[model samples]
Target: MNKAQEKPIALSIRNLVKTYGKVAAIDNVSLDIASGEFLSLLGPSGSGKSTILMAIAGFVTPDSGEILLNGQKIDALSPEKRQFGVVFQGYALFPHMSVRGNIAYPLKLRGIKGAELDAQVERTIDLVHLSALADRMPRQLSGGQQQRVALARALVFDPSVVLLDEPLSALDKKLRAELQFELRSLHQRLGTTFVNVTHDQEEAMTMSDRIVILRDGAVQQIGAPDSLYNRPSTRFVADFLGRANFLEGAVSSVNGTELKIDVKGIAVRHAKGKDAAAQGEKTLLALRPERIAVVSPDQAKTSLNRIDGSVQTSAFVGSQYVYVIDTPLGTIESQMPAFEAGPLRQPGAQVAVTWSPEAGVLVKDK
Candidate 1:
């Protein structure tokens, strides 16, 4: 088991369901968050990621089911009573409040005073690297700085859990990337249970120990970032987590731990997974673009599953070259590192794509 799984449960959501009119915003979702584990609720819009976070924070009441914190049910607790720090999408800093004042507000609300409040505020500000700008107003700080201030505010009270609702979505791409690292580092340093909600796949994969993928109003899959990305259980997950090229075929034969599939009359070999299909059963294989290697037809290895194709198009995407290869199976996307892709293949260049049997993950056709 992973370290997170070894730890005790910090929070648990059991049979959580919420609805509006006839639509269920959050279906019967159940999850257990390990102590100090950074978990992300990730999905597209209207997927109930935010609703689950809000329910945990006591802001949204569930239609049914219970929320337990450290084994104690807290379904009746108010937002403030829950004592969970929340950083909303908007920084929501008070215009009149200085950095120090904003971070101190939480303490003051709890009746903390004088030296105690000031010391806590200063320490949290320093933690977020905003000590130099303690007196600056929200308008005076850059977007990154403002985000830090908001994070400082959340950490000031030293809550057991911190909920972040797409906290870095408002920043530019570069700043967002920088903050993703910083936020992940902060979570580690603080060792606080963090439940983050976001629609950005990269952001969730970057900062989360485990990701809960939701669709519509239900949980689709929950697992470690690499596990979910590599062994996605459904078509939506395979497509959502990253760029995946799916090969549809029927299992022609099973040889020990491997299965040979027939894709458009060509035999495709795949390593058997837990849900290995029976012979003659339809199968769908999820192959990541980066797993495919483009080579000259003569250079293809017999041990690997090889498909003859011609480069339909190729685009250089900084670190890698993404190629659209037209093969008998269908159009397949391949990503190769720029340094190793050799000379770029022009349109209609005859090439063959090869990948190990293990590279093709068996996924539910759905």
Candidate 2:
């Protein structure tokens, strides 16, 4: 885990809103980004993720609320005056300029003299591991290399913060994965606060120290990757972060941190322990598919939760087997590791699906 510093806050947004006539593009939103941290704003298209990044970069002025950097208001400041480096979705490299010239442009614009400009460009090239391709033009380099060149150009000036708007979206999967590792390593080496926006969940999880999930122009949740994955707050978040089986039920009892939910005709006991549901309230339980286990019918092992169902279908997916079972409540999905030693269950086979109480997390019915 990365330890957050106790320095002054890097960026703070309070009650931010952007309305375009009849449509409220961005609703009231508040966020705090710690200094020297890597944070990712992750959401689908039109979810206001990019809008928040633009607001932070001073590209789009918010209709209301203040944009603060180190606790000083900068809402009225121009984009150049804000002094934040930006790398947009496409690698917006000038086709006419070589990689060295691209990196030197920022320093040149700042009126850095001959020797300083050369040194800064060389240093930036080394920082992005592009020393060998300094003389290569944008059109001559691969997509991954071009993206790195753009990144080098952005960081050459050593700005206080960097805003990355899906920098690796153009690369192939393998290249994207490679760049993801490089970006994380670079963030650690530079210790610069990075605010990035991406719609890819894997990218968000792989690179960010904290993730801000947005939806419908509002923040849905914000937490570390593991925290968000293990304990999602809303139905949308659970579904978006990963695959989840929704169990609709009404809470029958709440004792301390425990909950008893009635699903269909069965009263299922859940040990959400610290995440208890309100008594006599309707709730949706998020059951991760991987947490379920398929058991033999005769194995009468007493467990926290158990359902008898017929295997509706099963598919082997190399490393794991996905099974769909029709239980009394509803169709439940479970995944089991593919084993070479045994023959798995076929369609219409009767089986028992069992999970621990804590596997089912009580969430909003939204």
Scored by TM-score, the top model is 1
For all candidates in order, the CA lDDT equals: 0.93, 0.88
Q: How accurate is candidate 2 locally (lDDT)?
A: 0.88
Query: Residues 1-366, candidate 2, lDDT per residue (tens digit)?
Result: 335535557999999999788666689999888898899999988889898999999989899998899899999999999989999899789889999988888888889978888888898899999999999889899999999999998999999999999999989999999999999999999999999999999999999989999997899999888889988988999999988999988888877657889998688888866575678888889999999988777763686788999999998887888999999988999888878314678999899999888887877766
lDDT, candidate 1, at 220: 96
User: Could you give candidate 1's per-residue lDDT for residues 7-117 as a string of tens digits?
Assistant: 999999999999999999999999999999999999999999999999999999999999999999999999999999999999999989999999999999999999999
The reply for model 2, stretches above 4 Å from the true place, is: 5-7, 254-257, 339-344
Q: TM-score of the candidate numbered 1? A: 0.98
Cα lDDT for residue 330, model 1? Answer: 88
The C-alpha TM-scores of every prediction are: 0.98, 0.93
Best-performing candidate as measured by lDDT: 1
